[model samples]
Target: MGTINDGNTHPGATLPWGMASALPHTKDFREKANGPAYYNFGDEKIYGFGNVNLSGLGCPVAGAVPLKLSTGKFDWDIENFASTYKDEEAYAGYYKVTLEKHQLVAEMTATTRSTIYNFTPQNDDKQPINLFLDLGANTSHRKGGSLKVVSPQLITGSQLDGAFCGFQKSTNIYFALEINQPNPQVKIYENQKVTDKREVKGDKAGVVWTLDQLDQGKLEVRVGISFVSEKNALDNLRKEQGDLSFEGIHQKAIAEWNKQLQKVDIETSSNDDEQIFYTALYHSLLLPHVISDVNGEYYSREIDKVLVADDYTRYSTYSLWDTYRTLHPLLALLYPKEQRDMVVTMLEMYKEWGWLPKWELFGYDTFVMVGDPAVPVISDTYLKGITDFDTELAIEAMLATAANTKKNPTRPGISQYIEHGYIPIDDRGGDPQKFSWTNGIVWGPVSTTLEYNLADYNIAQLANVLGKNELAKEYYRRSDSYKKLYDPKTTFFRPKLKNGNWMESFNPTDRFFDIRWEGSGGKGFVEGNAWQYNFFVPHAMNDLKSLMGEEVFLSKLNDLFSNGEYDLTNEPDITYPYLFNYVKGHEKKTQQLVREKGDLHFTNTPSGIPGNDDAGTLSAWLVFSQLGFFPDAPGIPTYQLTTPKFEKATIHLDDYVYNGQTIEIIKTGENDRYFNQFTIDGKVREEVYQLSHQELVSTNELVFNTVSERLSEVKE
Candidate 1:
């Protein structure tokens, strides 16, 4: 269709050495619009969304059907011509499609590393190919340039030596199609000023040859991708293909999906939801990509201002602030082995870099967001009973990072939080700064307070569990440090002055700026203001109620839910929806809010995320809600229940259940997303929430019911 190859000067791509026999797979069994239902063969999963660009879903057209090349390649014409086959019960990562226009049979395979598409065109009018390589189809950091075309015949005869650089400047990546047979009539189509082609039959494709042809239909093109240079792309093509045809590789990829889909048996009547969930889960696991040398050596710039030996794979591009809540937790549960390895990697990173990372990017610990969320990630793993490593060493490293470093972008507020119980609206360390003028300072004090408190609570709980009483006591005391920030006068924790005087003109919602890191939303705190931050004291909810009084706490909770202001589209109020679980007789509200928030906020789109997916934050909420539970706090070993989306689902843990029991949740007649009661194996329970990881691991069957409460009765 369309061909653009700069020139052949670069060396060949290297083969991927980390290849494992562990095939790629998925638990989802639903089908979608375009491709075969879904296929996870080896390291890939394929979805068929005929013409819709679901940002980052990585549609399955790459392998089966050649990329559609056009003059203005920015727009995809596939949308006008076809629709992906949509079936609900189809298994994960496997899809079969019959093209609407050409009736071409196509199936796709998606894995962690590769995508394969197989198409059999029936009425071939010269296959009328539209293969376009839009070099700009990548992340924001990508730079496009020309690619080299090296086949067996061209590489040996011409004898070009050095690296044949790409046509466009700054084009760091390249592609080469390992074809089945040498076609005589190969010419670069629609290319201006560059029309060239050479045959390479027996010898392997090397850098000496030039890529200047658009073979529309004659030969089958094997398209392999890599982040490394073109030489490596060729190298990968050789190692992966060698003598195997493109169809051979496609078949191998399909087999990989079949194996992984066999992991968990999903038995749901609604095939559509099941398909969406499994594919969503599959896409969720695809990113935070690994960019490294062929030998798997990645760039590591630990906090020590020096390079260190990076033995374990270093993953980058995570939004930890959002992911820490649910994504990380979900990984620890479903993929424990992967989770353990990731934890080990974090520990090694801590050793190399002094502080544990909050948000680690490529070779740099870019602390983009507030919160020592690393604590929760590790602690959630430990509390959820996935402790397989050196717990003491992990804690030691965690403590060092939290204690050794005190300041970040919002250090002023964090330091004050550690020193004065609450961050003061007025400057205590020095003269008032510009940000001190804002109101967000009301919530700005939360980052360190919550971080240290959670770290302390987790470490203490872990220490006591591990028989280290002294360490436990020390951390337990540290956990209580939040008491210093609680102001009794307003019945709400407010920022204080250096001399413990309340700041003048203290309106929680009035002032806008905060001196805290990034001003959260204005200066007092992170993305949310006081209304959202008030419910953050996860362990001290009872204490918070004591200050506001039961009536006030209930009223505040009521106001938060009804006030369109408590947006579920953001992360600040994540725990707020579940606060009703803390209040006695208010469990129904918790159920209603959790389901509403879960259902309304999630959509399959580029804008699906209200905030950063942050590595799995939103996914975690889905997994927990669907399972009928969520961890309210890190160290606190309990989960609150929301209405479940499924009637029954089985969670597979490594070693928790004696043949895991089926968790069944019954929905109320009114489509209102709230719950009325919970049952342990059909017996009604007193509490409104579900079991935490600890409880779930230790307990048996769980079932839940819900009812809608009248506004009058709710107040009463």
Candidate 2:
């Protein structure tokens, strides 16, 4: 799931939310570590490792500094340094692999900020280990950097990388590399040009070293990275790994992962579902990663300055447009305190960046995807009872983005959306500053309008909770703007021209909206067709049903699945299966669709994930589905009930918030697919559609009386 579909998750040693990863780079037939993913099943030749990478994201994640090692001599040909290998093993915070050509065994362990590597070279000649520190080699575009050898055993440098999803946002990575061996000789390389100078700086710069001495017949290296500065990188390495042995650090990392995984435990009959479930859980927690240094300092790309976090730990890499759906809600459920800090991070981003994050990467607003997504994420968190931050400031930020018209970064066409009820397809105000919106640059006016409607819907949710009824009413009315885009002729939400005319000959399946005359054949739906985005109104489900009529809505939903319209790859319709619960007496369809999609798309292989993880966007969908509840409508803080894959699933809620309570879901009955009903702590539920956060944590158990194949008919 992490390796395929541009998930780009490297097989390496990295702590939970760790800034640095020790990734094993390979020289493959297509492309090796120089590509998005560091380790794939088909990759050949192991060329040592790189120090940092983005995990499970959909963009091209550049390698910070790749360290390639060989056992014999100094060579300018980096191609000759790699060796073919076997025997690979990976665990949390640890990875082990062997180089078959050189008979070398390499292992790595990671801290939150650094990755510690151990290499054992079984060279019959007992030659010194030769290593290359490539500052220039990157998986993505490398914008020239500088490197210096501070000492015989130490090297420090920085690499400038940017344009996540082709958005013009760059991050400067600084690293301090240390060799555990004593009496090491060094040289420099600038674009493969060798020099005796201890320092080098260029587009292709690196430091080569030969280590003659080793401890216990092993060569160990440590590299720490920071976005702030080289000094902070060195201090991060020293502060975390100081006075600790390799085993001690590895054990500490393992313990931390154990504690994290222990939050949710499951017992199930199907072994594959269990493996896939835990793997999904693991992938879900790897994003919105820690960006603050050990001393609580971080580089703010929004302001182009270094800022202090003061008290709370800062984090970045918010793929909010994707994560606000379920990843954050899951966090708000399992780890409210951590989720609180994440909310604080988002608020801080608004304060520093002048706008909330669209798809934030290291404090840089990539604005990769459409929508003011921070609205739903913060509102969802607050509605779930984790309100510790400034309520006024949050509301203020929401209002600013909701009202700001000209040069709006998050909401591109606010004034147009307000005047026309929905954004017009020809609105020039929708052009994004630095974003790749699939085929064309005329940002999905229809899709962006839907995103804005959802954002406004969530803003209303927050406003209602804050006791501002008039403000809530205004936003709620604004949220129903999706109704204007709904064309009665096609019965699907299609694009409308600014002149109050429908797009000529509307085709819902066309992915390219009628923008550029060349690509007008395809409907523009922001990486999807109108079919997928048609039923994406999760928040206004009842209103959507009212618009299309009850029977029409149900028939369209059935057509969506039977006619192969429900998309498993995109985010807009990921919650489609659970939509059945929104309509009464059709909850049985939700169960069947959930199980069928789970069986088809998710698996225990490299391509288990149907699409890009998008920083755990798809993985969170799987995690929630497997747990018998899906946050079908994000920002509503209500889980749509379904048949859990596991027989007995235990979700240990946050002790401080839930008062040491745990939500135990015990599913056992004649059928696994259809359940007659479920009971919460011995009380039967009249409604099967939703469960609130408060009611969920306030209970002890939810036992679903289940059935299988649904081979038997469901009893209404």
Best by lDDT: 2
Model 1: per-residue Cα lDDT over 1-716, one tens digit each: 00001110001111111111111111111111122111222212222221111112211111111233211112232232222332222233344544434334555433222334445554544434333332222221222234344544211111111111110111122344444335422233112222354432111222211123324433243444343434544454466556764456556655654443333345568765565455445444533444443334444544323233245454544456666666676666565655666666666667776666665544445454566667777777777677776787788876774454243332225455556655565653433253332122233554346555666677777777889899889877877776665555655545556787765555544326534334345334466665666666676678778767888888877876676558554566677878887777777677667766765655443233344343445555665776677777766667777777776565544443223433334453443455566677667777556575655664556655545444313422
Please give, for residues 562-613, the per-residue lDDT of candidate 2 as tens digits: 7787877778888988887877777888888898898788997777888678
lDDT of 1 at 182: 50
lDDT of 1 at 168: 14
Clashes of each: 81, 12
- Give the TM-score of each candidate: 0.69, 0.95
**Candidate 1 RMSD computed on C-alpha atoms after optimal superposition onto the true structure:** 10.4
